[model samples]
Target: MVIATGTLLLALPVASETGQPVKIVDALFTATSATCVTGLITVDTPTTYSLFGEIVIMALIQTGGLGFMTLSTLVALLLGKRITLKERLVMQEALNQLTVEGVVRLSRYVLFFTFLTEGLGALLLGLRFSRDMPPGQAFYFGVFHAVSAFCNAGFSLFSANLMDYRGDLLVNLVITALIILGGLGFSVVADVYTKRSWQRLSLHSKIVIRTTMWLIIIGTLMFLALEYTNSKSLAPLPLGEKVLASYFQAVTPRTAGFNTLNIGDLRPVTLLLIIILMFIGASPGSTGGGIKTSTFTTIAVAVWSIIQGKCDIEIFGRRLPRGTVLKALAVASVSLLLVVTVTGIMLVTEQEEMEIILFEVVSAFGTVGLSAGLTPQLTVAGKLLITATMYSGRVGPLTLAFAIAQRLGRQGIKHYPEEGVIIG
Candidate 1:
């Protein structure tokens, strides 16, 4: 519904640079990308959209990134209306909480954290941008990019999309810091804020923190090694810029989608590595999207336990519930199937190479907007396919399935005696 409304608004003549309504396909594509917080663009944002259009897009990105439920809750609070049980249930599902306990308080925290963080980012970025442009324009740019980065929505007002700022330390540091904070789920941030001790944090927070750190470290090292000598990417830069670019590229694939390096110029191996990182995306209850860090870590822990011939999956001194393990595996399986099916369809319908098509499809599915220069040239069918993927990725495969099942009426569990199948 939000995307539909955004589509209608963007299709207005007031939203375009030439005082004409954008084509329906283009409007819908842009709306989906912004509302899903995916940075993919069929039209160059700065060149195609007027100031009014840019403001609309930024609004959509903020609404999409913080999520519909979170905003609605804030509105309800402002209205002094009580949150009924039904609303609490909806909030629970929207925030990916395990229960309804403290959901309202959490919503308050979400709004507070979001505004405070975005404000700080905007101040820093605005001060930096003021050096390059007039104060008013600098402030606007700072606010737009700060919201975009904090929401993990990579939409940029600049035509080159931060490529010109690749060597600017302040820009890189501020943007990456916002991306990391946004990708680290709000619940984790709240936990850290309140507890301020690693040992006192919840098990989920521990796993998410550990997994995110390891992925960033590994991705940075791998990117540096693989693209270190590739002239098109990292080789021409001085050692410091190369390292900076490596870190930026590494972090962006975790569903932030801002790129300081040309994504198309990377080697096949480097691209494949990025695919893996995008697939495992941000943690749950965060602005970003993907299968999620918790999901990936749960699956890995389960596999490790099996390999060790252990009966239980244990992490951070707590044994995971059987249902948690099952849900994690289910999410991964469904995500893989969705990615494979979408990639296959694109390959059949589009004239692009296998690698390019696969990359685009994964980018859509992960809501990680880095493209191999394929987004703007997509055919109508390709655009529609990607739009649907962005929506699905943002909502999550399992959540979509659950919604469908509920619409069709819930089915009761029916268990039968198990018979072992042949082992691999």
Candidate 2:
């Protein structure tokens, strides 16, 4: 529903002041990108899309980031209607809640939390934007950017993204804050608000919080060390500016695409770092995509357990469930396979370099939006591949494939025993 509505909006004359009709494929592509919160674009957004078009894109990003089911629940609440049990089940799935019983309350919390964070983020960003833009325009820019940042959607009205204000402390802080809040997973935020103590938080919340903090800190340091003296981009910057730039770049790739540095100018090592970050992505139940941080953490723990010759994975004094570890492995393996296959196809169809194709594939799968300056140059086939990748990344490949492939069948009586395999 979100995709269709967004596509229609993109096609409508009201969305663009240019008076030129956008091609259907382009419209569909843009809509899918916006609705999936992936920032790949065939056309330059700021130049091709007028203010009206920008607003439509922003709306689509908002709805997509929040999930369509959450938006529907909000509307139902606004109309003073009761949410049915069936609707609650759907909401549970949409929000990735533990159970369907308290979906009504969960929906309310989601809406409330979203508005609160976005509102605060806008106020901070608006104060900074007022220095350059007129009050009204600044306010609009602030609101749009705040929502985009919080959603980790990576769509920006400014043609240069955050590059123009790369060293601006206020801009850096505000945008990073929004991105962190959005990528931290709503459930973690909710738990922090309700529990008011770290020790009282659930296991999921603990893992997410710990993993996110570690990633941000380690990522920031690694980026600073790797790029500080690189002549292409970071070398000329002052100490403080370099640190700030590194921090921003570090945070941006955890599924947010805003860049303070020229992506194409980065060292190969920095690009590799970005690929790892994008692959891990934001926490589960967050607006961002990729395999997710929890999955990464689980995989890491599982690997450690194997190295220690342990039969079971454990973390933070708790035994990890077998099913959880299996799921994480499955998700990571599938994500990697998808990226490799898509990258290979792109390489054959497009004449771009391996680096560019790999970057595009990772960007699509991660929904990270960072590019090797090749997004606008993609051929029709490349664009379609990216669109499919973005959709699969957002909906999840396994779920979407299963939904299409599912069939009713009787259980087989025969059972096969597990067999030992050759070790490496």
Candidate 3:
């Protein structure tokens, strides 16, 4: 419904720079991308959109990033409406919280933290941008980029998408910080906010922080090493800038698509590394998408446990629930299926090669907007296919599965005897 309204508004003549009506296909695609917090754009945002349209896109990005449920709850609370049990349950599901208790309080924290972070981020960015742009223009750019980065919605006013800022440590650091904060998931942030010590953190929080740190460290090292000789990407830059660029490239694929490096020019090895990072995107309940770091970590631990002949998956001196393991498997399986299915469809319909198409499909599924430059040339049908993929990716596999599980529950609950099947 939000996407549809945004599409309609964007399709208006007032939304376009030339005062000409936007194409329905492009409008729908943009709406979906913005609302899904997927940064893929068919049209150049700054040149093609008016300020009105940009605002709408940003609004969609915020709504989608924090989630509509969170926003609606905010409104409800502001209006002094008592949040009912049903409303709390819906928010619990939306935020992927473990329990029904304190979900409203969590929602409140989510909203408050979102505004505070984005505001501070915008201020820092504005100060840096003012040196180059007029105060108003700089402020505008700052607010937009801050919101985009914080939402992990990679939509940029600049057509090159932060390429010009490759050497600017101020811009790079601020943007990347916003991305990391947003992608860390509200729950994790809140956990840290409430409990500032390492030992006091929940096991889930510990794993997320640890995995995130390792990924950024490893990714930075690998990118700096791999792209050091590639003139088109990192080679021509100064040593300091190269490291900064490498670090930005490493972190952005955790479902934040603000790229300082040219994604297309990277070697196959770097792209594969990025693809793995994108697939194992941000933490759960983050503004970002992908199967999530938790799901990836859970799967890895489960596999390792099997290899070690352990009956239980253990982490941080605690045994994980079996349901968590099952859900992780379900998420990974569904995500892989979606990516494969979309790639197959694009292969049949589009003219792009296998690697490029796979990249695009994974990008859409991961809700990461870093494209290999194939978005502009896709047909209307191809765009529609990607739009659906973006929606599914943003909503997530487990959410859809849970909805189905609810439907199945209504029919009747039944349990059957376990049956053995041959294994590899």
Scored by lDDT, the top model is 1
Q: State the lDDT of candidate 2 residue by residue for 276-390, as single tens digits.
A: 9998999878888888888899999999999999998999889987767777787788889999999999999999888778988898888888888888888888888998999
TM match of model 1 to true structure: 0.97
379: Cα error in model 2, Å? 0.4
Worst 10 residues of 1 by lDDT: 401-410
Report the lDDT tens digits of candidate 1 across residue range 247-333.
999999888788988899999999999999999999999998888999899999999999999999999899998767777777788
- The order by descending TM-score is 1, 3, 2
lDDT of 3 by residue, 1-424 (tens): 9999999999999999999988999999999999999899999999988999999999999998999999999899999999999989998889888788999999999999999999999999899989988999988988999999999989998889999889998899899999999999889999998999988999899989998999999999999999999989888889999999999999999887888877889888888888888888898889999998888888999999999999999988989887778778888898999899999999988998888888888888888898988888898889999999999998868586566445543544676899999989
Cα-based lDDT at residue 411, candidate 1: 50
TM-scores of the models, in the given order? Answer: 0.97, 0.95, 0.96
Q: How accurate is candidate 3 locally (lDDT)?
A: 0.90
- lDDT for model 2, please: 0.85
TM-score of 3: 0.96
After superposition, the stretches of candidate 2 with alpha carbons farther than 4 Å from their true spots are: 397-414
